[model samples]
Target: ARVMVAMEAELQQHPAQGVLVVGDVNSTLAAAVSAKKLHLPLIHVEAGLRSGDRNMPEEINRLATDAITDLFFVTEPSGQEALLREGHPASRIHFVGNVMIDNLFHQIGRLRADPAAGGRGAALRAGLGDRPYGVVTLHRPSNVDHPEQLAGLVGTLRTLASDLPLVFPVHPRTRSNLSRFGIDLGPNIHTTTPLSYMEFLCLWKDAEIILTDSGGLQEESSAVGVRCVTLRDSTERPVTITDGTNILAGTNPARILDVARTALAQPASGKRPLLWDGRAAERILDVIVDSPLFQPV
Candidate 1:
């Protein structure tokens, strides 16, 4: 909180001509506040997302950001509608698609070009050792704050590990919860530090199933044609659910295990086509460059 306040003060002192704040909804609120004070136009790249739970802080940030942002760069039609329903003028919302898709497409090409690709693949093969593996990541505070809920999630993973290995790239928050709740990670569960974006993309591409509470990973998993089991009770990205690429398993141990087993058994074969064509940044740039509001002083 102190850091955010300090940074905001600094930005206020020397405001840039155009400022774009991307990633995590928390910064959205800060951007909104900053825009109001600095008189700089704020562009929310992946805006209009709402988990519908104000207790989550992210929902609060999303609402606050959308309320004050001059332009909304949405990922899907639903996101656009969300902004509209919030009383934002239609002219302000532009469906520029998801930037994560752009990152994935770019990184996939990089991985192919790198000579270490073969070595990484080899390491993954050795680590997995012919065993089908599912990737799991849980970071939402609602799920991890409660000991019973956290234990249930871990139990579900343990049950799924009976058939296939569950690779968990443990987020620091989740690790802390595990230690706090005294939840044990079994032999079949492999926990590692948070992976780089490229490494995570490779893992998502290769995983038999992805069980996660992350919105970005859900989208990426679907883009790569991988089956995903969402651990949340509900999602802001309903496109994944409607497209049949992801299933909401909530936090129930039995349901998580059951849905994960089902997803692994019948993985989606054809890519269901991503919401964006990996040109969101370019589109946003075009909009900003062409808009009358973007004139240079």
Candidate 2:
């Protein structure tokens, strides 16, 4: 509510031709509401994604943001289909590719140019070296909010860590829960505080596989063709599963292990989804410039 009020005040002071909001975060929904109320054109980027689980707050945000969106810039074909199914006109929806992937590619290019650019990346390599390892990141409320559920997932990581090093960049919530639940990550699992984007990219890009409950990680890992085992039951970004290296293992320990083993055995395919070619921002600009909202009345 605070964000909405502040956004409303800012827009009133100096209005934009259109208000753009990205992703399913709470701030996105707040800004979207403020734009609609002010009668400004609402543009939604990374729009039309649905995990079909109202239980997730992000799903509600996505639904609400798209409901009032005048222009929809989608990342995948699934987004196009989803919006059409929701009765949004086809002309209003434009498939512009994933801007997150654009940034991922950009950062990877920077890393390649200067390997020692980020001291954290160098520090990570000095410790872990070239040995094949796995990355673990868990923070979703579904995974970390409960003791039993968190224990089961951590135990799975513990078993995997026994064979090879698993770099666990623990989320603050997950770390707190670990202390609260009396769960041990085991000695084999290398636990660290959360990492910066470049530090994390350097760490996970070279890993043999990644175990995560993060939606962005699913897509990022897939972009590099690194096998990713998503901890959640469902994902809003289904393109990663169909075209990238992501496997949905949910919270089931047995299934996670099975998928992890399988993923480890297979080589990174390096396959990327269509239009993830680091030019999504350009396409978004093209759409915005051509749209009616941008035209002089």
Candidate 1 wrong stretches, greater than 4 Å: 1-14, 115-125, 269-275
- Give per-residue CA lDDT, model 1, range 1-297, as digits (tens): 654686577786886765677754665577567666778788888888777877766777777777778888887777888988888988878988789888888888888888365344435546887777888888988888899989888888888887888888889988998998899989999887887776667666777888999888878877767889899888887777776388888877888887877777774744544456788889999998887678865
Q: What lDDT score goes with residue 158 in model 2?
A: 90
Summed backbone clashes in each candidate are: 0, 0
Q: How would you encode candidate 2's per-residue C-alpha lDDT over 1-297 as one tens digit per residue? A: 999999999999997888999999999999999999999999999999989999999999999999999999999899999999999999999998899999999999999998876557557656876677888999899999999998988888899988888998889999999999999999989888888888888888888889998989988888888899999999999999999999889889889998898878778664799998889999999988988888999
Distance (Å) between predicted and true CA of 228, model 2? 0.4
How many pairs in model 2 have backbone atoms within 3 A of each other, for residues 3 or more apart or on separate chains, i.e. clashes? 0
lDDT of 1 at 225: 76
Instruction: Please provide TM-scores, in order, for all candidate models, with all chains considered together.
Output: 0.91, 0.98
Q: List the pairs of residues colliding in candidate 2.
A: none
Please list the residue runs of candidate 2 whose C-alpha ends up more than 4 Å from where it truly belongs after superposition: none
